[model samples]
Structure formats: C-alpha cells, structure tokens
Target: MPLHRLLYTSEARLSDNASGADLMVESIVAHSQANNEKRGLTGALLYVRGTFIQALEGPLDALENTFERICHDFRHARLTLVDMSPASERMFERWSMTYLAQNDEPARLLVNRDLEELYFTVSTNAAEAMRQMRGLLLGEGKKPALEVV
Candidate 1:
C-alpha cells in the first residue's frame, strides 16, 4: 500500500548525565516496533541522547493515530512535528524503529544529501543529530554497547 510520510523533530533538555540515553531509546524504538507490527506501519526511529527525530510512513489513518501516541509519548523532554510528506516506498520494511548515536558530522551530512537527492524521510536524521549532540553533551561514546539479543 502507498504511504504518507510524517516527519517530526523535537528536543528537550535532558538531565546533564549519561544514563538517560537507554530509557530514551527504549521509549520509542521498543514500543513503536511492537505497536506498529500488528498494524502494518513501517518506520524508523533515531533518538539522539537528548533529542528524538522519528520518521513514520504508512496508511494515513494508521500514521495519524500513531503520531498522536508519539506526541503524547513522555520520553522526550520536548516534542515537535517537523513535516508531512509523501513517499513512493517505505525506507524500513519491517514495522520497527532503531536507535543510534549521532557520533560525528558525517551522519548529518549524509542526511542532508539524502534529503536532497533520495526521496526518503528526514525525521530520523533529526534524531541522528540529536544523538550526536547528546553524546557530545555527556562526553562519552568512546566504546560500543554489547548488543543484547
């Protein structure tokens, strides 16, 4: 089915500490994947330590309903909707969202290039930058997390 894409980027001041990143990621990524799986929504989530930018593409009704939940989702310190756009295809096939840190300028630059050239959603980019920003703010990320299966 064709999808209507909704893009949003919102930021709120997080505790000036390091432990908050995990809870932030889990708030949207975990629940989003579970919730959307049954509804056939496809999207990805990028939550920078202190900020969140999410991209959701699906049937308008489903997207709208989910967006409402996202808006009210308490994980973010602050939330704002950035855009609403159309997509020819979904970027992520599975109904899930992933979390990653924005470590360098490379990710932001990549997002800009894709936003201009590829018909893809940028909400994730918004989160990417936030992740990098948060990493910078807390002064960590010299290593990687042991992914738990």
Candidate 2:
C-alpha cells in the first residue's frame, strides 16, 4: 500500500518545570516508539517553545487513528492539521518515532530559525516544517538511540 503523511502543530501543555517537561517528553517518546512500530508508522517529532510539530507517515487508517488519539491527549491543545496527503515515501522510515526537543543536539538547527515565527506561519508552511525536521534528523549524522527493527 502507498504511504500517507500527516503533519500537525499544537500547543504543548507540558509541565512548568523544565525537568518535569523532560520526563514527560521522554515518556511520550518511549510510548510512541512502541505504538508507532506496531502500527507501521514512521515520523519525527519536534518540541520547542511550547509547541509540537510532528510529521507522521503510514497507512491512512493508522495515521488517522494516531491523529485522533493526539487530538484527545491533554498534553496537547490548539491542534492544527498542517498537512495531510499521499506521500511518495516515508521520510523517517528507519525510526518508529524520532524525538527532537529544544535541548537535543539536533535541535541546534532551530536556534538560528525563529520558532515562534514558524509556529505562527506553520499552517501556510507545512512543507518547510517537514523539511526542517528532516534536516535536523540528518544534520547530527548519528543514528537515533531508538529505531524500528
């Protein structure tokens, strides 16, 4: 079956404390890695400046189900579907879910870009967001600690 990709941005409802937020992100990535692998999903997640931008690629049904779950999660609000369409191939195929946060080394690419501006313009620049996420994954040159077998 051909793959479909969905990109979205949402207001992150994480803990006020930095450490608490780190733990929450860790738990989220761990849970997502397991579930995404089982559902044949591959994607990258970027969390920075109180926002979440994720791109998920998989079978349509699985992608829809995952999006629905995200919509209902208390950790996210102001969910905006940035883009959804048939994709020629998966962008992050090796990983079930690659998590990138503001503190991660890969996120250094974001330092030069105005994330607050990106968040405001995301609906119109969904493709750019995806490209940036892919760039972050490739920039580090080291494989993520978590990958789908």
Candidate 3:
C-alpha cells in the first residue's frame, strides 16, 4: 500500500497545568496507540506551550480518516494542516503514537520560537518539520538553529 505522512499543528484547549497536560497526553497516547496499531499507522505527537505538533504516516485513506477525527476533536482548536504528501517510508515506524511533553529538550526547543512563527514555519516548510521531528525522536539533545521563514 502507498504510504503518506500528514503533519499538523493545533492549539490545545486543555488546561496548561503540568498535571492536566500530562493526563491529557497520556490519554491521547493510549487511545492513539490502540487505534493506530489496529489501522497500521505510526506517528509522534509533541505537546508544547499549549500547542500540538504531530506527524502521522499510513495509508492515504487511514491518514485522512484519522485527520478528520482530529479536526472534530473538542480538545483542541485552530487545527492547521501543515504538510501532507506521499512518504517513501515512515519516520516513526517504531511508535504507534509516541508522545513528547513540553519539558523535553526537543519540545522546548521547538516552542522556543513564538507560536505564530512556529506555525508559519511548519505550514510553509515540510522539510523543516521533518527535520525537527526527526531531531526530537533521535534525541539530538541540542536545539536546531531553525531559520524563521
């Protein structure tokens, strides 16, 4: 089956408290893992500064269905589809749905820029989004010097 990757960003509607955010992330991870596994999908979700940046890869139909459900989810707002295209391979193949919290170094690095700037970057540059996501998953430990476009 042909594979595709869909990347997106959304403003989180849940409380920003650490505990509340943790709970929400945990719930999302659990639910995503179960559903994605069943559908042969893989992805990663990063929550930072009241926003979520995520990338999911799977069959085109499955990715579209999953994205539709996300669009209707009440837990977030301002859903923006960043990039969607055919992918040669899955970038997050090992994870059904990996979760990264705000405090993580990579997540912190990604949100260091203003929210608007970050969204603009992702929306305009798919390569940069892939770079950031790969860096985070690979535990690069250093913040990428992403140029604001």
- Which 10 consecutive residues of model 1 have the lowest summed lDDT? 111-120
Order the numbered candidates by lDDT, best leading: 2, 3, 1
Quote model 1's TM-score: 0.60
Candidate 3's C-alpha lDDT? Answer: 0.77
lDDT of 2 at 27: 88
Tens-place lDDT digits, model 2, residues 24-72: 9888888999999999999988786788988999999999999999999
Separate clash counts for every candidate = 2, 0, 0
TM-score: which candidate is best? Answer: 2
Off by over 4 Å in 3: 104-120, 140-149
Summarize candidate 1's per-residue lDDT along 1-149 as a digit string, tens digits: 66877767667444455567556555556777788876778665544434556667778888989888867766554577766666677655643554444444653544333323222233345444333423432234543222211
Q: Which candidate is the best by lDDT?
A: 2
**Per-residue alpha-carbon lDDT of model 3 for 37-135, expressed as tens digits?**
999899988766678988999999999999999999998799988889998988888789887654545645554443335445676797677667766
Q: TM-score-based ranking, best first? A: 2, 3, 1
How does candidate 2 fare on TM-score? 0.83
Clashes of 3: 0
